[model samples]
Structure formats: structure tokens, C-alpha cells
Target: MSGHTTTFLDGLEALAASPLSPALEETTRLRLLDWLGCTLAGAASERARLGQMLASAGDGPAPVIGTGQTVAPLSAALLNGMASHVVELDDGHRYGITHAGGPLIAALLAMAHDPRMDQARFLKGIVLGYEAALRVAIACQPEAKLNGWHGSGVFGVIGAAMGTAVALGFDRVQLNAALAAACTSASGMVKAFGPGSELKPYNAGHPALNGLAAALAAEAGFPGPEDILDGPHGLIEMLRGSPVPPGALSVAPPYCIETVYLKPYASCRYAHAPVEAALRLKAEHGIAPADITAVQVETYGLAVHKHDHTEIDGPYSARLGIPYCVGAALALGETGMAAFSETALNDPETLRLMRATRVTEDPALSALVPAKRAAHVSLTLRNSSEVATQVDLPLGEPEVPLRAPDLRAKFADLARTAALSEARITALADAVLDPQTDPRTALSDL
Candidate 1:
């Protein structure tokens, strides 16, 4: 690969071979904890229950996050991955526009079942997995999303395969073959978000299934195009409609995982900006939802394209509707899980505000995407007074991260919702954060 034509695998190889710094390791731990909380919380959902049924065929030694069930490694990976993303509370990368942790960590947990896996190796696997997925997604860039392809579904298989290869101690050649196999399996559509959105989590689940299958196939001496990611009709070219850009996949330090945004609210990441803007206006002006005459939200193009819906059919749909999120945030002073609950969905006041909301694209803000996921909100009150607020980024982004206490509280709340004892919750949190803790023993309680 040439200077500007650095391929995704080239970047993946460099990232895999690089030394893991303390900061990278720390970020891995945080991501693990975050993924765990999301998985546990979502485990109770009907979508997760359906996933569990679909994956319950084989028996093996892999824990299904909050279900306290042991299934085959591949099944566990699929179930946990789906559960983690069902609530839309998983960590997201702005540049990649994908949720890496769902597929990557879900596969890693299943791989960690091996007695051979240690804490350092587990952490390294996560970093490499995130690097693999994020690089591929970055290479695809705006084109992939523009084509209606979901990054998590398309790139997640790569992430899961890369991380699993690390845990299995694959040589470079095997890893390349595995990635090639994964590339062939990549598929997802944005239509999953339109209606009957309960199937949305399947996009997250299938990555773990296909990725593990690819890595295992490669491990068994299966062969694939070694240059599948950069050669003729490679994954990047097919997804991006062009050759890889210069330095598109060059090795950079402080890997993508370091900057992943954790979702403080249980809705789509695209909706968070509007929700934050609405909440800010509500907090600043002390205007009740009933007093609001109209609500307008201006955001990036992708956000408007994907989330402008106001006709929410259920909680899942509500989570994707920017209008519902902003209206709910203003009406309830919050946009957490409660805002998407059945009760809130049926609330007359929330519906009234949702109907009054309009979401439009701001070209200036749209140009800043993959760098700044921003939104601006303007609320007109009963007295014809106007209040406005702009949010450059939602909370839980690295720059506007949740405080330590807040992170802990989020974990605790999610665990409790999953029916985990307070003691188990605390223990799990401590174990995940401690570098010395054994991956197997730390999760014994679960």
C-alpha cells in the first residue's frame, strides 16, 4: 500500500503489533464496564429474550451477561451482543459512526472463557478489535452510511473476528484470512430502523455470530483472499465507492477506543444532541412542557435523515425519533430509559410536545459531522417567548464525559434493573476496573 493508499489491514497489522499503553488499557476497562451495564440492562427486553431463544440450541461454557445462562461460545457472543445494543445505550465512535463494544466485547467475553486468557491479553484483544472495526468504518466513511449500510453491522464482524483471533493467538496470516472471511459476511440495512425496529438489535447480534465463525474458520486452515480489504473489489472500495484515501488506515497512537462515546441516555446516539439541547432549554428557562407552543431542532444531515420521525410506534421507535427524544426530554426533564417507557410513550403531554417538534438539517452543522455531532434547539413558549440552546456534543463523550460517580451510578442502576443484587453489582464493577482481577473469577457471580 502506498502513502495515502494505506489499506485497512495495514492499519490493523500496525495496531495489532503496537505496544498497548496504560491509557489504552484503562479505556478498555471502562468500555468493558460500560458494555456490561448496557448488556445487563437490555437483557430484560423482549428482543433479548427472543435472541436468547434463537441462541439456546448448543450447550457450552459461556455466560450470557444478565441471564445467568451458559451457552455455546458463539451463542453467548450473539446473545450478549444483541442485548448490549438493544437499548441503544452502547458506546459509539463518531468517526466510525459504529458501536464497537457490542460485537467486540461480546466476542471477547466468550473467548475469555478459556483458562489461557489473562487480563492483559483480554484488554489487548479489545483494543485490537476496536482498532480493526474503526479503521474499516473510517475507510468507508460517509459513503457507507450514505448507502444505507449500518456500520455496526458491516464493520462489527471485522472487530469480532480480530478480537477473537487475538484471544486464540492467531498469527498475522491467519488474522488476515479471518478478516477476509469477515468482509465477505458483512451486511446490514438502515431500513431496520424504519418500523418494526425490534429487529434492529439483530444487526448487532449477527456480527458476533459471523465474526466468530470467520475467525474459527481461518483458525481451521480455511483460506480467503489475503488482500480482501484493499485489493480489486476489496471491502473498502465496495463500501466507499472509491479507493482508500491517503493515510486512511495509517497507524495512529491512542486507538479509537480511547475516544468512544458512552451513552448516558437509552436512545439513539443521533437523538442525544437534540435531547440535550431540549433539556438545557428546559432547565434554563423553567418552561413547562404544556407551556411550549413549538419545538425546532436543527442538527447534522445524518441525524435528520435517520431520526426526524415523530410517529413513534413503540419504545424502540421512540428511541430513534429525534422529535420524541427532544419532546420527552423537555417534558420529563430526562431522556433516560424512563422517557421511552410505555407509560411515557402513551403520555398525552409527551405526545403533544412530540407532535409540536420539528427536526431539520443545518448545512453548517452537517459539514462538521464525524468530528462534531451537534444540534441546536429552539423552543417557543405559551407567551411567545423563545429559548434556544446548542449542543456540540452529548454527554459521555470523552470531552464531556460522565463523572466517575455518575458512571458508577449508571452501572448500579442498570444492574438493579436486571435484578442483580447491589453486592453483585459493586463486586462486578470493582472486578472489571481492577487490572489484577481474573476475567473468569471476576465474572463468577454473574
Candidate 2:
């Protein structure tokens, strides 16, 4: 399992042969549905304006998720992935910092709609992509995010390329070439979030497009390095600032599917635990919004970086703002897609709550994140009565997983905002759960 020997192609081969659990398959399918719903909602958003422009430029037969128009496969993946994450409501793996479902599902659906790709292979490719992204993210480890890179774009390129290669039935050599090309083309920066730049959504979309381009390039007789991930100028060295460790590319059982955290809240994953803690305290003590005087949240080191919003504004800002998310949860008793809206951000009560909320980094808690994402919140009442709640496992943690019912409910909630019909919602959920039944057929009705 030497790093050089364990190439992306090798990982893809292992994943293709790996046995997928029925439950895992169901999870993957449901995630697809959730991401599709997000994409559909974002199709008309100003955040997705770039995606719309790109979609209009292509005329291939690949279907965009919400829109009826078809574009080139790469173009569709880029647009769909961009739109899916435009609202920041898409699914993300907490540890990986990669929005697994966004790019992966976008590319899978674009390929799935192609008559040449059978449903079974399409589904398998999606699973393979998930595993690949997770592994690459893990191998890159702490440096993946610290080095001013977006894991979804850097590692996601590898995952999307591997997934697309699988769906296209590339031989091992071709798959290796595709991955090499992906490794070379992958690029994203964490700086996009710092300034509330429109580039944030492109972080999700660009990797998908690069990945598809990699696969297409490989198919068109391009040659790539056999050691793209471990070479001196490889992805790990360039993006991660270190060579990938030996045996870093092994594709194990369960993969990252078991470790992936489905987001229950639309905000940053770092903020979820604090919000959960606050919500738990509010629910248990029956604390009203006016009863809170101040709130203090102790979370990982990243919380300080995320919550330090002296100039927060707009939905994107709220989504990345820890104080805003915690305050909204405390004041509204919930934090969902609706809570990140412009109206919600400008709410007087939410601002008051945000002003009262203070966030700090706890080394002890910081050590537990990515795997745990734990947090502790302290609430002080108007009368100085204090209550504290700590959450080690939030709602969507791998251990405290969200059930099918909860996922369906979340889909419906998002659909309500998107104006999707009840029938459309049900059909979308069913088509994802049973992807063999042509999910596009359900989209047609929409």
C-alpha cells in the first residue's frame, strides 16, 4: 500500500469492487435528492448567476438539475455544482471540508442522464466519488484546509474525475491519467469566504468542471503522471505543502460514507454544535427569546476565525457567521435555510442576539472537532440565572444520524421555499432512493 502504488486509479478499482451496504446506498441516494433540491432552489439565485451564464453557453445534451435545458456534461456539472452550493445549504463532510454531494452528485446526475450510462454504474460512480474525495481529504489532513485551499475543489477534482471515469468505463490506465489530470487542474482557496466573494460557490463548481475535463482529456489520448499525488510538484506537495504519506491512498471498507456528517443546519458545520447546544437549552428549559441576556459559545479554534464577523452582511455572511447562527437559533428556536435569508439577517431581534453572543476557542473542544464537532453554550437570563448545555454529537453526526423521516422533512422544508409541488417533492425523494426508476422522469414533472 505504498503511496505511489496506491494511485487514484487503484483506489477507484478497489472502490468499484467494494461491496456497498444497502443502507449506505440509501444514504447516498437520499443525499443526491437533498443536493438536487438545493440546486433547484439556487438555479434562480443571484449567487448562481455565473452558473446560469455558463449553462447558457453550452448546448450539449446533459440536463441541468432544475432547468429543463441541457448543456455539455462538463458545463452541466459545473453549473449544477455551483447552483447546489450557491445557498450554502448543500451537504458537506465536516472533517473533509468538501461538499461531498454537491460536485459528486452534480457530475453523477449529468452522466446518469446520458443514455450510455446505466443506472447501476452511475450509482456506483457516485459512491466511488464519495470515497475518493474523503480519502484524499484525509490523506491531506490538517494542511488541506490550513494551507488556504478549499478541499471540495482540490480533493473534489480527484473524486469527481474518479467518479466520471468509473461511469465512462475507463480502464485502470485511463483512470490513472484522468486522476493525474484532475490533480493538476484542481484549485480552490479559502480566501473566498473571508471577503464574502462570489468565488465561494465557484469553489464547488470549478473542481467538478476540472474533474470532467480531466476525464475527457484522458479519453482523448492525454497522458498523465503515475505519481501526480506524490510527485515533487504533485497535488499533495503543491496544495498541501507536503508529500502525501506512504500508504495514504488505500481505499478501505465503508470508506468515508460512515464518517460523513450530513448537515442538519445550513450554516457552517463549525457553528452547528453551538446552535444545537443553544437549541437544546432553549427546548429543555422553555427559555423564551427575551429571557436570554447573553450567550457564550466555546468551540474549536476555527470558530473564532468563522465567527469574527465585525462586518457581516447578507445570506453568505450569515451562513459563515457563528455568532449569527447561534443567535438565530437562540432567538428563533431554530436555524435553517430560512434563518439565513436577507430578512432574517436584518431582523432586529437576531441582531440583538448576535450582539449578545460571544464565541471563543477551547483547545479541548478544538481537539475534538471534525470527528465530533462538539460545543458548549452558556446562557445567562435577564435575572442572571445561568444554564449551560453541551453537545458532543449534533443531530447529523455519524453517531447521532438523521433518519429518513428527518431528511424527507428537510427536503420538504426546502421545497416549500423553492415552490416545488408536494408531488414533485415525493417523486424526487422516491427517484433518488430508487435511482433505477429514472430520477429525471420526476424532474420532468417539475
Candidate 3:
């Protein structure tokens, strides 16, 4: 391959061979903790229970998250991946627009059952996985999403495969073969987020299943596409249309995980902006739910187009509806798991506000999306008062990240909700944050 054309292969080789820095390792460690909290919390959900049933057949050593039951490695990967994403609380990268930690962490955990994978190898695997997914995402860009393909489902196939390959110690050729296989498996429709969204979490699991299959296929010496990503009519061309960006393949250092966004709220990432705005208004003015007469949220195109639903009957739609999230944030001053609970769903005041709210796709804000993700909110009060606020970067973005204490509290909150004892929660958090702690031991208590 020519130097310019070899970007995909070169990037794959570099990330697979590169060692993560200590700082990045710590970041990875924190995200691991964050991921476990999401998994444990999600395991209690109805969706996660269904995932367990689907993956219940595997009897391998890999443990599905938050349960003592062991399943086959692939099943474990699928269940854990699905659980992590079920709550919409997993880590997300804006550029890639996929929750990277779900598939990456799930694949790595399933692979860790070998008892030979060290903590260092585990961390490196996650970095490489994010690298692969992020590169693919960059190439696809707005074009992929514009066409209704979910990046997590499409980009994550190769990413999860790469992580599995890293964990299994695959060489360049085997990794390429695995990626080729993954390309064949890439799929997911944004339609899953529409009405009757039960298939949404399954979209997250698809990558884990397909990715592991690709890696295992490579290890078994099953020949697959070697140039499936960059060749004519390859994965990129098929998904992104012709004339894809050259920079998409130009892999750089410091990796993609450096800017990963962890969730501070349980709602969709797209809704966080309005949620934050509403929360800020409530906090600053100390307004009760009854004090607000109407709310208007203006945001970017995708958020308005996909997330503008006014009625949220269940947890699934509650997590996806911007109107519900903003109303809940305004009413309760928070949008965590509690806000999506059954009680929260029946909240009369919140329902009233949700019904009264308006969400529109602002032309200016829409123009800035996939870049700024900004949102503007205007609230009208009962006593002839008005308030407005805007947020460019939501709280969990790297620019305005949750502090260490807040991160700890977030995890502690989820751990408690998952019924973990104080001792087990503390030990798990300690192990997850400690650079030297093995991932296997970190998960032992769970």
C-alpha cells in the first residue's frame, strides 16, 4: 500500500503496539470504575435481565456483570456490553458518537477470564479499542449519522475486535483479518432509538458478539478480508459514501480516550445540555415545580430531531426524551436514575412541565453540532418572570469534567443502588483506581 493509503493499517499497527502513558492509565482506571458502576446499576433493569437470558447458554468462566452466574465468553461479552449501555449512563466520545466503554470494557472483561491477561495489557487493550473506533467514527463523521447509521453499532465492531485481538495477543496480520471479519458484521440503525426502543441496548451488544467472533475466527486461522476497511467498496466507502476524509485514517498520539465523556446523569447525552440548563435555573432561583409555567429548549439538529419526544411512559423513553429530562431536572433539580423511576414518571408537576415545554432545532445551534453540542433554554415563571441559560459543553465533557469527589460519589451512588455493600464498594473502587490492581481482582467482589 502507498504511504498515504496505508493510514488505516498504520493506525491499527501503531495503537496495537503503543504503550499507554501513566496519566492515560489513570484515566482508563477511572473509566473502568465508571463502567462497572454502570454495569452493576444496569444489571437490575428489565432490559439487562432479558440480556442475561439471551446470553445464559454460555458456561465458560467469564462472569456477567453484577451476577455470580458464569456464561460463555461471547455470552458474557454480550450481556455485559448490553447491561453497560442499557442505562444510557456509559462513557461516550463525541467525535465517535459511540459509547466506547460498553463494547470495549465488555470485550476486555470477557477476555480476562484466561487468568493470563495482566492489568497493563487490559488498559492497553481499551486504548487500542477506542483508537480503532474513534478513527472509524472520524471518517464516517456527520455523513454516517446523517444517513441514520448508529456509530456504536457500526464502528464498534472493529473496535471490539481490535480490543479482543489485543487481549489475545494477535499480530498485525491476524488483527487485519479480524478487522476484515468485523467489517462484514458492522450494522445498527438509529431507528432503534425510535418508538418501541427495546432493541437499543441490543445494538450495543451486537459489536461485542461480532467483534469476539472475528477475533476468534482469526485465531482459528479462518481467512477473512484483509483490506475490507480501505479497499474499493470497503466498509468506509459503503458507510460514508465516496470521498471520505483522509484525516479519518491519519491516526495520532495521546489516543482518543483522552477526551472521553462519562455520564453525570442517566439521560441520553444529547439531552444533557437542556437538562443542565434546567438544573442550573432551578438551583439558582430555588423555583419549585409549580413556579414554572412553560419551558422552551432550543438545541442542535439531532437532539431536536430525535430526542424531542414529550411523553416518556417508561424508563427507556424517559432516558431518551429531552422534554422529560428537562422537566425532571427542573422539577427535582436532578436527572439521575431516581428521576427516571416509576414515581418520577407519575409526577404530576413534572408531567405538566413536560407537556408545556417546547423543543426546537435552532438553525445556529444545529450548524454547530458534532462540534459544540450547545443548547439554550428559556423558562417562563407563573409570576410574570423569565429565565434563560445556555451551556456549550455539558458537565461531563473533559473541559468541564466531574471532580474526583463527584466521580467517587457518582460511583458510590450507583454501587449502592446495585445493592453492593459498603465494604465491597470501597474495595472495588480502590482496585479500579489503583494502576497496579488486576482487573480480575477488581471485579471479584461484583
Candidate 4:
């Protein structure tokens, strides 16, 4: 048993020391760009404003993303993580059901603040963090989610620790300790949905802070149970409330980050397929919102279970509601930030459409989950006409990846949405997209 644990830790350490392929490095850069766009766009939110205020009060070496403020490394990680996730547009993995980039990148930036940190090393850390954290998430998901736990708050902490360990050059022992310590603080609840969804960003922030602290503790000679990830009562059993699945911890991969999806809508990932379905119905059938009598949506059980609500209290609530997202997409032909704005949320027509929308679970679709985020949408018209569409996978999934030009356009739009000046947006874009740029300098100037 001890040897198994030792082998696991050694494998992780070796992954950290391994070199990334050119393709993997490119993907890392894109993920960074995506995270930066999300963080910068989210900086305008009240949550990010509060985070910046809290971090600005403290002084340290780490730069808080989307702000000119500097704070302690931990504080920076918390703030950046919060900002990145606040907009609900961060990149996410389908199988793991986790947003790996937000917290992992937050931790990496916090630890890579030193001018001497190599850009290659920082990028490698990003890749490693996603691999490790997402693997844990894959091992615990659906079950953990069904148990009311959020993977970002749980598995994300471990991912952050692994990434930080790589950045800080921690040995296998220290890495193991860091991971073990992270498990102690792994927690977040799915009840944060609906009107309480505004608190969801804390899942990313809390994990980023805790994961960084865990790695730092290990670096400072603190001891922890190395087998906390796989031993008795370890994170797998604790989170899943069952025995660890066989081979769940295996490191074999073409890089799990490659499978992560970049969000095309500013709503929960569960809502994406439905939104796409609705948009297709509107565009192809030329069905106006006024002409639609009612809508029925069938999707995977997890989506229907988590996002079926129509009673939206605010922007955050709107993001979590599949009914609202589908309604907005049908009504406005889009589900970007504008769809959740005060005017849109309060629009009587949109609300009426939302009320008329119904969501249900299709067992076939449910079984397809973690492999395909399929959705079926049908609309009945005032004239008794019917239109239907089914999306096996929404845009931005690995199979339907967003084009580089489109991704860059998204970044530019988000930067402008954050009220960034033209020059700053250009500079930030250049810095993030260029592999030769110093990460510390690229991050600090924002």
C-alpha cells in the first residue's frame, strides 16, 4: 500500500519535471488567454470589486489579475480565482465537470510572481495542474455532485497545489504533503445555485487560496499524510462516499487539457447545449419569440436537475437557470452578458418565455453525459406550427472548438466589457498570446 502511494507521488513529480509538447504548450497559452478574458471581464462585477478591495488593503509581491493592485500570494490567488469565475464563462472539462483553469492559473500566477520564474516552467505548471486536478475530479464527479459537492471547490484545490508545487520546484515528498493538506480543505456546495449563485465564485477563490497555502506549508517543512489522496478515508472515498474507482489516478493522457471546453455563452455549461438548440430553432425556422407558444427541453439528468429553474432573481441566478438561458437565446438570439442584464432580466416578454419553458431529463441523453452534452429542444407556435432541434455537443467543445479568430474576438470583447482602455487591452492581449513574454510582467502590468 505504501509503495502504491509512493509510486503515485513519484508519477506526479515526474509529470511536473516532464517537458510539454508544442501542441500542449499552445493549448496552455489559449487556456491562459481564456482565463485572462474571463477574469478581466468579471473584474467589473461586485464580487471582483469586493475581492480587489480586500486584496488592495494588503501588500505583497503577487499581482491581482485585472487590477493594478498587489497583495500577498495567497490573496492574489483568491482574488484572481474569484474574478475569473465570476462571469461564469471560464473554460471547463466535460468529464471532470470542473473548471480547472480558473483556480489552477490563479495559483500559478501567484507563485510565479518572481521575475526569475521561467515562462516555460509557468506554462508547464498550468498543464500539470489541469491534468492532476481534472483527474481527481473525473474520479469523484457525478457522485460527488449528486452528494451536493462542487468539484471546483473540492478537486480544484488539489489541482492548485500540484501546479504550485511544480512552479515552486517541490520534490515528491513536498508535493505529496501539499496534496494531502489540500484535501483537508476541499469543500463547496451545489446549493450555491439559483438566487445564491452569486456566491459560486468563492468555490474557485477558496480552493485557489487553500491549495496555494497547502503547497507553501509543505515547502516550509510542514508534514502531512502522503496517502490522503488514495489511502483509507482519502479524498476519493470522502468525496464520492465510496471506494476509489480502479485506475482513476492513472496519468496516461494526450493531455486532459485538450478536452476542456471553452464556453461560448455567458451561462452555466449545462445551459449551453440548450441555448444552442434554441438559437438554432430561431435561426433556422425563423420563429420569433412572440410566435412561440411553449418550449420543451430534454437534456442530461445532471443539467435538468441543476439548471431547470426559471425563477431568476438576478444576473447570477439567470446564469444558472436553463430556462432563462434558453428563453434569452430564443428571444434575443444571444446569451452573452447582455442577455442577463437588468433590462433583459426584467423584460416581460423574456420572463413570459422563461415561464413557458419546460426542462426534463432524457435517460438516453443522461447516459451520454461526460461523453456528450446533448440536448433536445422543441417549440410550439401560436399557429400550431412546431420546430425542433437537437444538439449533441454545443459550440466550443473539443469536437466543435472555437476558431482562433473567434477566441481572440471573445477576448477583445471581454476586455472592452471590463472597461479596459484600448491600449491596455492590446497590451494585455499581446502579452497573453505571446509565448516569449514574461508571465510575471504580463500579469503585473494589468
Tens-place lDDT per residue, model 3, 93-208, is 88778777788788788888665567777788888888888778877767788888998888887788888788678877787788888889899999878876677777778798
Best candidate, lDDT: 4
Q: Candidate 4 residues 1-446, lDDT tens each?
A: 45334555666777777788767777888888889999887877654466546645477888776667778888888888888898899999888989988999999888786544578778888888898888788878889999999989988898898888877777777887888788897888888754564789889988999999998899898888767876557778777888764666777666778889999899999999999999988988878899998999999999987688878778887898899998888887768878878889988888889999999999999898888989999999999978898999999999999977778888888888878888877787777777677645777767
TM-score of 2: 0.93
Provide the global lDDT of candidate 1 against the true structure: 0.82
Models, CA RMSD each: 2.0, 2.2, 1.8, 1.8
- Assess every candidate by TM-score: 0.95, 0.93, 0.96, 0.96
lDDT of 1 by residue, 408-428 (tens): 788888887778888988998
Predicted candidate 3: what Cα RMSD to the true structure?
1.8
Off by over 4 Å in 4: 1-7, 47-57
Residue range 254-349, candidate 2, lDDT tens digits? 567666777788877778888889988989999998888898888888667756563466877777887888888887765887787777778777
Q: Candidate 1's error at 67, in angstroms?
A: 1.6
lDDT against the true structure, each candidate: 0.82, 0.76, 0.81, 0.83
lDDT of 4: 0.83
Rank ordering of all candidates by lDDT, starting from the highest: 4, 1, 3, 2
